[model samples]
Target: DAGVTQSPTHLIKTRGQQVTLRCSPISGHKSVSWYQQVLGQGPQFIFQYYEKEERGRGNFPDRFSARQFPNYSSELNVNALLLGDSALYLCASSLEQPRGNTIYFGEGSWLTVV
Candidate 1:
């Protein structure tokens, strides 16, 4: 099966702009998650969707939002991007097993703001 994948491996934007990142989960996966990793920091959970419904959310502002599709793929959108928003956005997927929480991450989408 194909592993999790993301598009636009890298991007550059200016402050106050908007950016949309895409993610496709592994085959047969039902859960997709989004995370943000700022420089020198661990990846912070942004959103987790299972069965096309939101399952979890992180401590981020409304500027950050995401949604999952029926096919289990997901997209993350950031509005009014700031220099502080420049970081790696990663997507993960799991089997929706609470006991076996093995999430596979993609190479990530790098966003840079000036």
Candidate 2:
């Protein structure tokens, strides 16, 4: 079975633009989380959805949003992109709460805003 999968391995955008990243979880998984990783910094949790409902959110601006479908796939959207937003967007999946579940991460979508 495949692990988490992400689309558009890389992307480049200008400030004020918008970007959307997609993810598909492994079979039987019911939770998906999104994270942003800046160079020289650890990943920052953006959002977490379980059974199509948002269960957790991190300290991000309103421009960041996400949704999980019935099938457990998810999409992360960022609006009004800024140079500061340039980073690797990662999607992780697990069977339940991330606290104890084995979370799996995708290769990540690299976004650069100039």
Candidate 3:
């Protein structure tokens, strides 16, 4: 059984461009979450979806959006990319249980905006 998988291991973009990142959860997982990690800092939660519906969101600009499909796969989109947006985008998946449940993370998509 594979853990969470993310596409496009690395990406480079200019300011004002847009990018989309994808993720697939492990089998039997029903929840997918997205996070942004800057250098030397912890990941910041971007969004969380469960059963194809959005359950939570973090303090990100409107340019950041995400959706989960019926199969529990997810995608994260960022528009008007800025230099500050350059970071590692991580996807995590877990069971739709209590808050303390263990969550699995993908290798992450590295994005650099110049």
In candidate 1, what are the lDDT values of residues 45-68, reduced to their tens digit? 899899999888899999999999
TM-score of each: 0.95, 0.97, 0.97
Cα RMSD, model 3: 0.9
Against the unseen true structure, what C-alpha lDDT does each candidate score? 0.92, 0.95, 0.94
Clashes of 1: 0
RMSD of each: 1.2, 0.7, 0.9
Residue 58's C-alpha lDDT in candidate 1? Answer: 93
> Which one wins by lDDT: 2 or 3?
2
List the candidate 3 regions with Cα displacement exceeding 4 Å: none
Compared with the true structure, what per-residue lDDT tens digits does model 3 show for residues 1-114?
888999999999999999999999989999999999999999999999999999999999999999999899999999999999999999999987328999999999999999
lDDT score, candidate 2: 0.95
